[model samples]
Target: MRIRHPGALWRGAQAAALAAAVCIGGFGTSGEARAEYADVVINNYSDAAGMRPVIFPHWFHRIRFRCKVCHADLGFQFKAGGNEINMVKIIDGQFCGACHNGDIAWSVENCNLCHSGKPGTPTQVHESTIQKLAIQPQAGGQQ
Candidate 1:
């Protein structure tokens, strides 16, 4: 057999690693893109005191409900910080409680589902989500 160039081997290895990352899903998925999910992030935003309220990752809700379910019925306000949602109201069947009374999205036992605000932390399942999206096919056929 002929000897192979070291540079070529490295390049091939790099490409394989990238493909594996994309495939094995430490990066993102290919299905979630078109899956029609909602992000809790600032499709809407408001200033408070000084800092931003919090970014809501819509993808978080995608696995749970449809857009109308929360935006129209639950009164999620469509935009971040737009709806009058909070822990107290959620517990009382006002905002999140519109369904979360153990019948939908999850139960009150999973309070941080909305309050955690961030993704992929101990509280929120956002990081795993990022990987899920990475592997998912892009929405509308665009990369």
Candidate 2:
């Protein structure tokens, strides 16, 4: 049957053409263009301590562990600042403490490792990576 709304068909064609042009140039759908591992900065709850925000680099962690190790086993919320981690919880062997204890990567005593004394570091990384990703195309069709 012939479609009655010709404008709808024209709009759909225009959208498809735009999407094709975008894909041909390298950027996929918005989801594909986004970074696979983004750095999460936890500062909303830590600013009171006068400490810099913790910049958790997902790319670094992804190198050694699977996503399930933290997302599923440790129960970390996927959203940034969603877990509400703090020093007390870390000392109690919760959240980051689950792995950062002396027996593992590094003890909480080494504060400078996570807290770089500069809140802007993580923000800069995130912004730069995002800008780069927007311009550069990924190696494969996948993210």
Candidate 3:
């Protein structure tokens, strides 16, 4: 039997687990692989500031980094719409700025990169059934 390095084995296991997660997460209820759009819409102040809401592509980040990187290390709240993310906080290297400060990722100066959501959209988690359920019916019994 050949001796395998412990670090190499750990890294291989990590890579395999990541691959499995990606493969499983990419499928839908119909068992077919589906594409995911921008996951979160951050419109806390974009509309008031005369800019489009930010479309945060969570899948893009999730595939590259583990959940703890943002949730635990960066102190991001796990629940949607829970974190009070703002430009002032970001520019101060608090949240997204930690990585998007022109080194690890694109700088905040590239407005269109993140602020590419549609006009008049509120901050929310996209593709959620909760949003569909929250829609009230019309006065005439129309959905």
**Which candidate number maximizes TM-score?**
3
Tens-digit lDDT track for model 1 on 47-111? 23222333455666566778888667766654434665555776888876776687764766753
RMSD of each: 13.8, 9.3, 12.5
The sequence of per-residue lDDT tens digits that candidate 2 reaches over residues 29-140 is 3433233447665565445667777778888999999999999999998766777778899999998999999987899999988885244222323434243335433322
Q: How accurate is candidate 3 locally (lDDT)?
A: 0.72
Span of 10 residues, lowest total lDDT, candidate 2:
120-129
Candidate 1 Cα errors over 4 Å, as ranges: 1-38, 41-56, 117-143
Question: Candidate 1's C-alpha lDDT?
Answer: 0.50
lDDT of each: 0.50, 0.66, 0.72
Estimate, for each residue in 1-143, the C-alpha lDDT of model 3 and write its tens digit.
23389887787877676566557654234212122554887777787899988888888998999989998999988666578888888899988988999999999999999999777666766655443324322312322
Distance from true location, Cα of 88 in model 2, Å: 0.8
Candidate 2, after superposition: displacement of residue 68 in Å?
0.2
What stretches of model 3 exceed 4 Å from their correct place?
1-38, 136-143
Best by lDDT: 3
